[model samples]
Target: MAKKADKYFKEDKWKIIEEGFNPDYGMVSESIFSLANEYMGVRGYFEEGYSGNKLIGSYFNGIYERSEPDYNHYKGVADFTEYMVNSVDWLYTRIEIDNEQLDLYKSDFEKFYRELDMKTGILTREFVWKTAKGKRIAIKFERCLSMTEVERSTWQASIKALNFNGKIYVTTGLDFSNIHRNSGENMWNCGEKFIQADKNITLGIEGTTINTGLKVSSNCKIQADYESMEEIIEDKLVAVKLCINLEKNKEQKITKIIRNLTLKDESQKEEYEDKKAKIKDGRDDVIVLNEELKEESRKWWENVWKRSDITIDNDIENQQGIRFCIFQMYQTYNGAVKGTNIGAKGLTGEAYNGNAFWDTETYCLPFYLFNDREGAKNLLYFRYKTLDEARKRAEVLDCEGAFYPIATISGKECCNLWQHASLQLQASTAVAYGIWFYEKMYNDKAFIKNYGLEMLIEISRMLATRGDFDKDGKYGYYCVMGPDEFQMMVHNNCYTNYMGRFTLKYTIEKVKEMKEKYPKEYEKVVKKINFKESEMNKWKQIIKNMIIPYSDDTLIFEQHDGFFKLPHVDIDSIPISDFPLYNHWSYDRIYRNDMIKQPDVLMFMLLFNSDFTKEQLKANYEFYEPRCIHESSLSPSVHSILANQLGKEEEAYDFFGFATRMDLDNYNRNTNEGIHTTSIAAAWMNIVYGFGGLRSDGEILSLSPTIPKNWDGYSFKLTYNDEILEVKVNKEEVTIKTLGNKLIEIKVFDKVELINDEGYTYKFT
Candidate 1:
């Protein structure tokens, strides 16, 4: 056995590099170096297009198209809905010299390098190539999506002739041929295109889906120093050509300014304007747009890094990995818009079909809440806006309350699996938990009165309908799925039951508060939803008798009904190649036997740490971790956080390493499809919640910092309750400082210290 080398471009506190070209790893690198601005994302494929294996993707957060055969089942159990469709390909460039096209694969090329500058949210590539006809040229390119403008991006390419003085031709365009790579059906239909040629070239194309009927438009204008001409070639491809005569060692540069707009951006149907007119308006401002966007994007990233940056002092690999995870997570979604949640693959690639999942509430929301509270509020607002759809889904399932979909684009359940999509039920609880988590830290009563209380009440109502009293008079849920997808149709899943109990209890409290504080709002909600006043008694009854499975002998909670009765084979017994049993064995075989894909019971215990004792946590973690295959990228961070809490530092670091490198090292061997967007946020959790031991209990923020053995120290900033605080831990002492002018109290290793408006630092000895 041999250890694999860590893959990255370079070791910097602030930059991500793909040091040299790895054509074999081209697609993976594209995912790693992907760029986004919370609105749109583009993968890092070559600008001078390659015929090699790659997914040329550009995505908008809410622009999607529908597909048929969503589920493999025979019954009409699934809904016909749109998944996030891959948008236009805006990075097409064809370079030719002396009648030969410049293909990196076929040419003599060297000094190939690519970098994603985190500081400015820009991606750059540089290389030198010798054409087959013996003409040598050097090329450098830079690209960025604007964070300030939110709808604009720029790509600039500079070409220099080193040895030959001859004619050079370049073709650049907004391409729709490679819009989607789906196998089943066309996700987008070509609609209309408009082009104009002058000193600069302007092109616009719009498409509507056959199923969803949502319209999306992308427009671009090219600016260059050479003579350029524009044309519409294939009804789908809009191209601009540049011709130049270059002298020895002379350089020529071309830049494209692009703007993307979709109907999703419109607040109302009548507000939607003509796509052609919008395209023309964008081109009219092309002179100063690129430079202005560049500066604004830089400033936005600067503020983001100031508030969210985490610095690991000694380990460069893990340091870079941690930052890369944070960078990508922020790039994917900033919680900018209401009614839009992050996808499993984000905007980077089309994997998971760009449907929102429970991962957004459970794994990704905390990151945004801690750094960008308004963004976090917007994410929850998405769920709030979709509440009516969830209620309708609950009716279809014959459940009493809203049944949040397992995966969705427009609030409809797109996943076909009955157990996963319909019965996982904990997803509803997760949304409730997110609300509670936010309210506990911020205590925004207006939010609860206006939005949060209604959601909690509906979810709690669902739980009351979903569960029943058993023969032993214990209320419990049956035939459900937990976080561990390997197990299905199980009874009394502890995670689901406990979270249901928590939601019911929390909802009761919030309703009482709402009635006392805002009687008018409470009455309005009651009238709007037809919520029964007597449902309170049902919620209390269910909460009082919720049966959570546990084992007296093992001192650990059971994952579900009869889980221990199965023949258990520890993961160590399986061959390394035979691991991730889902890939190697039949579903029935893996299902009947005991092999945990991730920590189901342990995850519940970790999230609700105060409920369980340390000894109990250790017992359950020890029992389940060895059996965990960690097939889900979401697995390792949970294990890592629990390990750190249980004082198993060695195990904690190992699991942290696994999570931090999940995408960077392609540990799951699936990075080619897309980076695991949720897991990236989980990696950040491993550092802050795991190593930093940060916890909030509705009153005070607390930390029990434990420095990793290999590191000198680590520091991170968090925005808590509208105040910024920094926590830095070294071998000997822990220091907490408030960066804002607000009085705050935080418990350090169980000791409370007050930081005042004067801004003070508290040191623990």
Candidate 2:
């Protein structure tokens, strides 16, 4: 059966709270409370240890290990795959009172409470332990990844003896024995360890076997009011044991400040050598103290709230949901580091092998574009850096130019399934869209000329060569899959063809503009790529002849050629146990039916909403909404946005919660795998694009806001055209006010209005 939201968490405007611990929902809670700061993420597993179901995930972005591939004679199949490997357990802790180690699964506990503070980026958990000898001890654990520092994490534990005076022992340090859950393999080889007992500090370094040049160094400093301390070093483990004398009703706090630095042999050799020399020379390992790190992260989160917070007045459930979404979005990625993109699970879990998909551009980019433009540029820049790998992938598939991978960790195609790895075209087109979209929002023409235009030209080349004309002389992609995974190897998938046309047309337009406005720089880029006039002519020709399936009578586009001829299955009739059909049903059985894994035609409609009329959107929404099973985490929010656009308010709200609480409620029964990072972005899209009526596809920023029935009002912020605008929607009217000093032009219900410091208001009819 599909999992329902466990609802174990208490609702609050700025926190996710759990009053009593439920072992049945342990993994789900771990995922919901996971903490990350772009640089690293750690699942909310027990620091004192849990014997029950749990994934001890602590991941660093861009650090990955490659696995041997199953050899296949097929040409387009991937020969090997690389995945993000599980790294150091920075929160590893062991608490011992009278030699009885604290284990939540085995120990007696009361008043178990945990909360993830959205406003401050801290996760706190506390419980009272009843020892075997009838002594009670209260313990609290708090952790936060520094938002400002990026590479540092602070873990603090407070303990008090409630009944009797006793000695409590705490062992904590960075542990490097983590295993990749999917492969059941420990990929790291412990390299070096240093301990300084007098200073209460330890450092360790480990390197992956396959990707040996990738090394991670963890330096930890222990601070506590303890009676004694000792350094303990073991195989693949480095820790310090602290003995603290506790008096009745007196609390003692121990803090572990950790800083992790990752280095690649290819890019960071000098920096790595310098750090190694410093460690060897016995220099102090620098780290931000706990309170200082906490303060810095507090200011960082405050700024994030000032710029990105969405306020929902009447519904605390959704209010908490949306904040949680925004908080996770920031935690997953803040663009602090270059050469990194949002993973499918965003360092939350091991699922998707810690690889990024097309969702980085298609779904996650808008969130960052509106909140952090620099970060958005980094996302696109990662693609540009990986362009050579993309070109190699296209050559492997017997095509020209760049073909961005379906999944990647270090910019190489890693998905093993040939069907998805080779046939899907959205990944390439999504990169082009990201470039176009980024330029549209920020008006950074230099970024396009310097970095984006080259990628766009190569992507246009890939799409042009990858597709061909049918016997009827109509250009379309054959044997391909669109956004909907359920229908594969189909010809003329409307979404794919339309996006291809968009990519080609956009690339052509940019090339012409560059030639006219910046002829000198344009000539340099053109010469670098060996520019040919014929290729541009061919792209224009393909754009003109691209076939997008549509029906004039119904005003509804067929999802793909022969899609209507496929036998239909009643999605509602499917048993709950059969959900996530990939697991329960035969693989071939899924593709034979008309059930959609996600939006295909509706996806393009949303991406290019400005190009379609209301009647066309309504017609397609009515026709396609029923067939979607929404197996993908990115599905529901797209439906929600379109439903709101069509005035189906009730249906829109129905799908809204699913995107916001997909992990919190554990609706898909897969939260154990990881947080749905893309769906988290979609939740933001639901509020801003769905209910707030914001559309960026057109020239002028537009809005046609509608308040949900349960909401008293809602407000959100958007960063556009180098200005921040606060948009508020209530029952009576919609308000748009610039947070900056500049006047902004926006379309409200098809009427143009100028908004400034005083704001512009449009009353509902």
Candidate 3:
């Protein structure tokens, strides 16, 4: 039987709440209550230490460790694999009362409650513990990562004696002995340790593998009303001990302020060495207090909500779901640093080895494009910075131009599977699509001319070299895998060919525009890359003849050339135990039938929505929806958006619920690994693009708003042409108003309308 959804979190508009603790749900709760700034993230492991089932995960954004590849005789396989290594436990703590240690699993406790507040980015938990001698004590823990200062975090605990006066001992420090759950090995070597008992501070440095050349320095300051203090130092650990006296009905508070500095550059290594000397001489580092950090993060989130919040009326479940999605989206990335991309797990867990997949461009970019244009540009700029590595990868595959990796971190192919590493073309094409989409949304020709055009041309060249004309004069890719991993090594996968055509066409158009608009700069780029006019002709011819499988009788495109000949399998008939079919069925049994792992044809249609007719969309969605198993987390949101377009209101809402709570409720039963970072972004898309009816594919931005029957009204914000447009949808009509002074024209229900300082409202027919 399939595992039932675990709905442990209570529904609230601004918080994710757990009424009582359950040891069985320990790991799941750890992932659900995780916290992160763009620089680092920590799982919600217990500070006082829990001996139950849990994965203690704390990760830095770009820090990773490399492993030697398994010996394989086959060519074109990766020679090394890199993983985002598990880092320091900045919240490591131990507590003792009346000479009895505290461990959540062994202790007697009651009134256990935990909450993650989305409004303020803080996690709070409180409970009352009974000691061995019957002394009663209440403790509350609060922690938050600083959004304003990316490197700082604060952990605070407030304690009070309920019945009798007692003494409490606390040990807190940074531990570098964290083991990676997947590899079961410690990946860091402790380099330096410093402790100052008089100052109540501790500091340590840890270094990763030599290949990564990365080191992290953690500085911590302790503040508490203590009668005495002591310093302890050990291999890979440095700590401070405090003894505090408590009176009946009086609360005592202890706070720890932590700052982490990473050294990734050779020049910075020298500077860090100099700073280490000063630290041993008792140099005090500046520390921001707990309240100061919390207030700053609150104001940051306040501005973020003003521009990106989605307000829904008469629906509490979706209200909390959508806010959690938006909150995680911003927490994962906000363009604070360059040369960094959102990983599959987004620093939440150690799944997918922290490598970024095609989902970054296909699922995550739209949310950032509409909200933080700079962040969107930074995502594309990562591709530009890694262009050389892409070219080297293409040379290894014997292709003409750049072929981006299917899974990557630090611009290298990291997937050990040969089939996926070599045959998938979506990553290269997705990069091209991202560049085109960014320029279309922002109208930033300067970005296109400087960085985007080079990547586009190279991607187009790879597409041209990778595909060829079939025996019947039709151009298509063979021996490839589409988005649906079920049917691999297929001919002319529809989505691949369609996106390939779009990439080539866009590249040619931009090259011509550059030549006409900025002739001098275009010449410079052309000379730098050694461009030729004949390659342009090849791209144009390929676009003109690219074959996309279609049929007139069914009015739907075949998923691939020979997909119709395969035997059909009724997806609903499969046993629930066999769900996540990859785990249950034989490897070859999955690809023998017509069951799809995810959306294939429907995906390209969604990306280029304006290119397809309504009848085409309805016909394809009807044929494909029944066959999709939604094994991938990226599947349901695509289905939801297309179902909305086809006016299948109930079906769309059902899929929307699945996409929004895929992690919150552990619908997939694998959220213990980490949060599904891309799916979280997709939930935002489900609201703005799915129900609010916003479409940016056409020349003018448009909306065809529809409200779910359960909701009385809904509203969201979109940034277009440097202006903020607030769209409100009710049962009777739709209202759109801009926050800026510029006049804008958009299509509302297939009719053109103009809005300025005032706004435009459209009534239902």
* Winning model by TM-score: 2
For model 3, residues 1-765, the per-residue Cα lDDT tens digits are 133467889999989999889998888889889998878999888988888888889988888888875676356778888888898898888889878888889999899999998889999999998899998889999999988778889999899999998789988888888788877888887776777655455555555544576898887777888988777777778887789899999999989888787776686788766665655565635446789889988988999999999999999888888898898988889887777889999988999999998989999999999999988998989899889989988888878789999998878988877778888899999999999899989889888888998898888888988889977777899888989999889989999999999999999999999999999879988998898968988787788889989999898999998898899999888988787788899999999989998899999999889999999999999999998988888888899999999999999988887767778889988888889999999898888889988888998988998999999999999888888889999999989999889888889887888877588888887
Write the residue-wise lDDT of candidate 1 on 199-308 in tens digits.
67787777665667776677788888775464656656677777877778988888888877777634544544554575675524433466777888888889988899
TM-score against truth, every candidate: 0.96, 0.98, 0.97
Model 3 ranges off by over 4 Å:
1-4, 199-202, 267-287
RMSD to truth, every model: 2.3, 1.6, 1.9
- Model 1: lDDT to the true structure: 0.81
Model 1 residue pairs with clashes: 9-17, 9-19
Clashing residue pairs found in predicted model 2: 5-665
lDDT of 2 by residue, 143-179 (tens): 9999877878899999999989989999888788877
Say which prediction, candidate 2 or candidate 3, comes out ahead on lDDT. Answer: 2
Report every candidate's CA lDDT: 0.81, 0.88, 0.87
**What order do candidates take by lDDT, descending?**
2, 3, 1
